[model samples]
Target: MTSGRDRLIEAATRLLTESPDREPSNRELCDAAGVAAPSLYHHFGTKEGLLDAVVDRAFGAYLKRKRGMLRTGDLVADFAAGWDLHIEFGVQNPVLYALMYGTRATSSAARTADDRLRKALHGLRDAGLLRIDVDTAAAMTTAMAVGCVTQLNRERRRADDPFATAMRSTLLETVTGLPASPSEPEFAARALVAHLEATSEGFTAPERALFQQWLRTIADTTRTVQDGQHQ
Candidate 1:
């Protein structure tokens, strides 16, 4: 029971995520969304307008999730929560993350989208919710979290191995400038779950199933790797 505008936005979101390299024709998107071409123009005006709307919708959802999970009263807790959400978003919706933030085609939109995240981090700093300088700490924290998620994605795709534990250890050490410890693993798992629960919208049932399969594969790989290490 989606309206024409809603259907158009949904179609645009999918195209933006799945095919950002080239612009999708209005006709194609309309066909995909089961809407007519005139309805797209009536609602969005033009292709660029449609793209802008798509970016807005995508980043709007992301910001809403981040804001919802704000750990404003404590520095370490806030950092941990933010990092967990970042990793979870990247893992659950790699395509959307890449399209919105990591792709060259959407670099302008990415920067615009990033401003929202930067603002949240800055607010945390203003509230003394973080111990480090706002800009440096935000950059470092985001880089480490995104790197961990990207590495996890690569490992999952290759079915090569699970480096979640090692990545979590490294991230804790690098971002917080803390020594890695045994307790980090439990923290990382908690963070992963938090992120997944927060930002896993726009995912179709099929994509969710694929991700679940990958998770199982990674779990099996982790067990094998841990056993080998012990031996």
Candidate 2:
């Protein structure tokens, strides 16, 4: 048996998909759900509350499928795949995506997606692949991705639009400095630090921490010089 709450949710979802251009009224939703307006207020407190529930339900399903994605150890590929998945979700569920991301409403799934991006960037940082700090990389990547998806959605384009790929590659290249020249000593230094941290066993905890710090400082200094030279 469908509970009134479930029925209301279904009705709202249907109205969202069908109307896409307008907000369905409480009366419309109640009539569609075969429930009274009081029931919606009783269950959700307000219309926005009901909308939040719908977004959570939809975004949660998307996240579940994302969690099932196979993890290849290649962090770059994993990051690309995740970006594509996000674009795919937004393109497929334009109404839901707009509600969750384009509107003022908050969604935990959106925050979880941001967390996942930061975690992926951290993995790249550990591998000496990121040229920028994790926080900056996350912020730039998120902005680029959201902008790309918003454009695609606004233009009613497909997920496979070339703009999406171009934006992804551009943001990633800027973030990771991919295809680094062999002469970049900073890369070598960071890589060495990562390897030592992963495999070396003799150092005490404080010693290891200090050693890692020293290596990162040298690498960061070298990187600053390289940036200056490029300009």
Candidate 3:
């Protein structure tokens, strides 16, 4: 049997899907759920809280699917799939996507999604396949993905729209330096940092920390030189 809380969520989800451009009224939600106003407050505290729960439930299911397929050994491919999945989810659930990520404050589900991306980027860094550090790469990739979703929502485009495809390729190439090998010293330095992070048998904690900083300097210096060359 569907509990009153579940009914409210289901009604809100339906209403959001039905009118992606509008928010459902609390009275409308209560009417659809066949529950009183007090029922909603009792279950979710407020309308915004109910919306958050709806977004959480929907996005949690989406993340479950993404997590299942994001670790097939090839981290770059995994990242690409994850990107596609994000855009696809946005296309399918524009209102939910907006609720999940369009706010000034980050949602818990959004943070979890970013953590997954960072974990994959860490793997790529360990394999010497990333030109930038993990955090920078994650930020760039996420910014691109979110911008793409926002654009698609504005334009009412499909997930496989050419614009999305081009953005994905461009973002990946810039962040990961794909097709062009990570042959630079920066890539080597990043790989070494990853290695040092894993093995700590010989050095004390402070020593390991200092050595990692040195490796990061090497990586950052190479990146600076490359940037200067580009300009």
Best lDDT goes to which candidate?
2
Output the lDDT of residue 23, model 3: 88
Q: Where does model 3 exceed 4 Å of error? A: 180-231
- Winner of 2 and 3 under TM-score: 2
For model 1, how does the per-residue alpha-carbon lDDT over 27-119 read when each residue is reduced to its tens digit?
889998898889988987987777667766666666666665523244444555555566666676766666555543354556764566567
The candidates, ranked best first by TM-score, are 2, 3, 1
The TM-score between candidate 2 and the true structure equals 0.73
lDDT of 1 at 146: 67
* Tens-digit lDDT string for candidate 3 (1-231): 899999999999999889877889999999999999999999999998898888788778777656444133446655665677778777877788877876512667677777777888888889988898888888788788878998998998988797987887887788778853222465445545654664577899999889878977886676677668869
In candidate 2, which residue pairs clash? Answer: none
The 10-residue segment with the lowest total lDDT in model 2? 179-188
Pairs clashing within candidate 3 = none
Per-candidate clashes, comma-separated = 0, 0, 0
Give lDDT for model 3.
0.77
Question: Per-prediction TM-score, please?
Answer: 0.60, 0.73, 0.72
**Local error of candidate 1 at 206, Å?**
30
Ranking by lDDT: 2, 3, 1
Give candidates' CA RMSD values in order: 8.9, 13.1, 13.3
Best by TM-score: 2
lDDT of each: 0.61, 0.77, 0.77
